[model samples]
Target chain A: MWGHVMSDEKKPVRKKLKAASEASRFMANYYHELDAASQKGQPKIAWCTSVGPAEILRALGFLVYFPETHAAMLGATRMSTELIPEANALGYSPDICSYLTADIGAFLRGVTPLSRIYKGIEAIPKPDVLVFNTNQCRDVQDWFAWYGKKFDAPVLGIYTHRNVGKITEAHVASIAKQMQELIEPLEKVSGRSFDLDRLKRVVALSRACSELWRNVLETASAKPSPLTFFDGTTLMGPAVVGRGTREAVDVYKILLAELNDRIKDKEGAIEDERFRIYWDGMPVWGRLRAHSDLFSGLKASVLASTYCNSWIFSALDENDPFNSMARAYTELFIVRSDDEKETYIKKMLELFKVDGVIYHDAKTCPNNTNCRYGMPQRLEQQTGLPSLTINADLNDMRMISDEQTQTNVEAFIEQLEENQT
Target chain B: MKSKPCYAGVDVGASRTKVAILDTSKNLIGHAVKKSGTDFTATADACLILALKMAGKKKSDIKNTVSTGYGRKNVSFARDTKTEIGCHAKGCFLYFPFATTIIDIGGQDNKVIKLDRSGKRTGFKMNRKCAAGTGAFLEEMAMRLDVSLEEMNGLASQSKNMIKLGSFCTVFSATEVLENIRQGKNLPDIVKGVYYSMIKRVLEMDALTEKVVMTGGVVAHNAFMVKMTEEMIGRKILVPDYPQLTGAIGAALYAMQNKP
Candidate 1:
């Protein structure tokens, strides 16, 4: 809200992403349906991690809900600060993942942003079952298990191996075997038979949606960058929570078309795009607007980031759904080696043509904080692109000093400008 | 005699405000440093007036002005604001003219800025979120030791058996300082420990390049701190003629370069 000036037109003029609003509306409707799932004879609710096998859950006739996405919404709406202390009061450490703490806090308060803002539900729908995989973070298991006990729901966890080197067929087969073993417990919890044919179709739709989302993000590579990573963070809601459904695919299809049209018309995120930057780690949930404006005010747009691109499943194989899903999910950039990370960072810098990089070291997340201290220096040495990291929390605004962060960013931009001269 | 236009730079730092005026040929004509009181605008204006008088010119003789430091925006008369990092690099480069790693220990922060051979900034870091390696910590230590700030440098230089501070944190170091004082440690030895603690914290912000240049208000008041820093790193460290005025001088240089 600090740096972004919204359009003043009475009609909704799309200065930002139109798909972001559509995704928000879709999420509100989805939550409403979840509230009335039993009355409307809709699918049962299943809580899962963002990177979990949501397609399988959809195939099992369950409405997938991601607590992480809900936490991010609370963060975006500036309500996480109000709810996080409730979890801290319950003995959750302030140093734990902010998403886990915020979700627990929100649940303990018996309220959701859906009811307060969107007028959709009085509370988040209680899960009939919970499922998770440890592809990205270690907190998901504990987060889901706690909710399972709180709501008297059955919990199902699929263990995934960390891919240290190249992911082999054996790794894929092992995870696929676990996926097969997972169905019986899920079937028992939802009281529905698992159908491979339906799962195959859902997996196909999920792959299609991921492709469209990747293409949408790639449009920023156009000269002047049609959108910034801030837009991507908002528009990424459907891809994370509503991955397998036709609605998710449709959202990205619309977003991809809009971004393509913007590229054709030479529209840019900032008026005068002077320097492009590669953003590392998560967005400072409470201060996204402040940071966004700080860069846009300097005519620099964060054209790409490693956070939003985490959901791009370009490695997914539709023909071999389970095995390919195993490889695709396990081989994420977050769980990769330093050499792999270096290649990925270098590739994004080249593709986006960024002049430098900015890293938000989320104090509450150890997973996101890896390779950060040394990565900037290594990247600069390898690619000749400069980088700076500011320490802040993702949801907790108390850990951030706006003035200090702004000063560091201004000095960094000034250095980038000097390099150009 | 012809009345010629001159440029000015104002650095409104946390502890003090500095002003430097330069003539057309890029010479440091006059400069002033004063305690930054409650009102930053008033203090900056006072500093500018004093500097202009020393340069034998009125305020109207200034053609352009640039500002820097934590309170850069508070200078109402400045036409534009440059970052302290950029200004520091430019000011040090004017003296060194080579690839340099500058360690500027300021009032509330410390900065480690690296520059390439062509005088462009390659990398830089600022330590503002903490008070471990800053002049604020020195003042706090001095107050805790019940000694005046001016006596710290001389006392540190006179230490025969120097004590090493057990903690790098300002609060903890202050507690340790109190404990040592209660245990009857020598005053100069305790002061020397404080100096060593400050230098150790500053050096850890970033690796020092071969040509290390130290600047800022802390270095201006404490020459022994620089001597200890050189000793710690086991190499010679370069410093500007007026260490506290480097940022202001760089801002004035910016004003000169931007003149229409």
Candidate 2:
């Protein structure tokens, strides 16, 4: 048995961040509470986007369910394909973000993978109201608005202007003002008073978790990075779903510790870790495993990404919660100019010490993917780091050609490998 | 003494399977291009056999095989697979040997790959979720215009005035073609517009470098496209002797370099 388990005799087992189990449990419980909200009949449930000010909802004694998270879950479970056609039948083009299609399709079909994963739940807790911010994409505004219309629920949207230069004080004030105005509509739906103290407490916890998550992501800066973008994508769920909660902070603390330990042991996400690459844009959610294996098989690990780093709160100021939240949300890398985006990419490349970049051109999100055609060239000119852009859809499984994607990625790794010589 | 080792590259494109066999001297000995059909495995095997016969070599003469393109993995006999991006870059660089941008408009997809002067690929971009720039779009337009794909090049070259297609989508472009035909637009003019649309779609994928090399079965069949691309970019575009065999040749190069 020992002989059979010799280094070259046995295939290497891909080691994941040990804290993943704890994080999954935290997410499951978070979902469980949201699913139980209607049964308890006391706390109301609200549907929100991943980037919405969920701390406010948490502070207001309502359980929040991020439909985007659920939609991603649908994608991972291979159930999205079944749900997408339902949306197609209802006039949603396959060209729209698959998250929207799958969510609406699941709702239209009256089922969810979550319901099946956790027994005794009919579906994701239906919301009493819907809330979202316009910091990310047009899809956020349209997706949440669709739910608001379907449920006849009052919708509260916090709109952020696309920042052309550095974020201004006026920008912060305007969005902070919206945060104040949001209280009334939320109060009306939840039938509860908005407590400022509770919000401050939630914001403090959110800041702590963001710090821990940032540290966890930074651990990949070590040679033979102990984490991959694939791991970060899954580990990021707590930061999105459990933001503003002590439980989420605890989860990240554990994750950060495990990552640091891996660094100490000289452990890597991929066994040889010959090269590190950065991934930009949304993941090909349906083909995450296939994509991950494509790189790891070549001894190249995608150690860092703009997608997972979107959750970090490097700009957040806990002392002035609302104003800082406004600044942090508005200055997202996605909405910034190509020149400014290059500056940030340069910083990430230095910090992660990556050899190359893989820019994923997700089909539906034009706001994020359209600017990509010029990015690879500009970044290469500036940093001397090569990049490859592979076309894919975030949730739509139909659009991906595994053969094409594999060929592109393999060739990219080959170039990186050749550069080593 | 061992006979000179030969390397083989198989490009399993979505629409067609291509094979190129090269001797150790890096000279192309034989090549074949055939429709991919439904079974990539069978098509790839058939292509390899046809090319091997053309080269007058037995299977034992081949030392290594590498595959690329959309159906790369379906080639069961290949020792390895490479992306069409790397292959296209290597293939084009072999011809130009300078900082070059490669535009490959295949049957179902289009790729724009950039390379440094040393033939190292610096970056690349592929058309996303649209068929406007690929050979499929042209095939649809050809069917809609009731002309053979082979005749499209000559017809477009004869046009005195080119008609512009408003819709970039294949389905919508077909309707646009019909509407143009009904409006009594000249056949040559309509075909010319289709070529312009194809060129515009690919050019929009990325910014071109000083030296641009165009490859693929579409360009191989439609020499007029090269002229159209040159006029549009206001610069001479480069093409390999056998445009359809570039990806396969790139794979063959990889095979020669990475022999087992």
DockQ each: 0.38, 0.27
Pairs in steric clash, model 1: none
- lDDT, candidate 1, B2-49, per-residue tens: 688899999999899999999998788989999998898889889988
| Cα lDDT for residue B194, candidate 1 | 95
Instruction: Give residue A33's error in model 2 in angstroms.
Output: 1.8
- Badly placed stretches (over 4 Å) of model 1 are A1-14, A38-42, B166-168
The residue-by-residue lDDT of candidate 2 on B53-89, one tens digit each, is 9998877788888888888767777887778878888
| Highest-TM-score candidate | 1
- Model 2's TM-score against the true structure: 0.90
In model 2, the Cα lDDT at residue B138 comes to 91
What is the per-candidate TM-score for chain B? 0.98, 0.98
Residue-wise C-alpha lDDT for candidate 2, range A1-421, written one tens digit per residue: 1101112222233577679999989988887887788678658988777878887788788888898899998888888988999988988888888888998999999989887777677777877988888777777778888888987877888887774467779988998899888888898888999988888888888888888988999999998899999999899999989888889999998888888888999999889888899998888878888778778877888989998988887666667878887777777886676667778888999999999988888877776673444767777878888887777788887877776677667767877876677
Candidate 2 CAPRI assessment class = acceptable
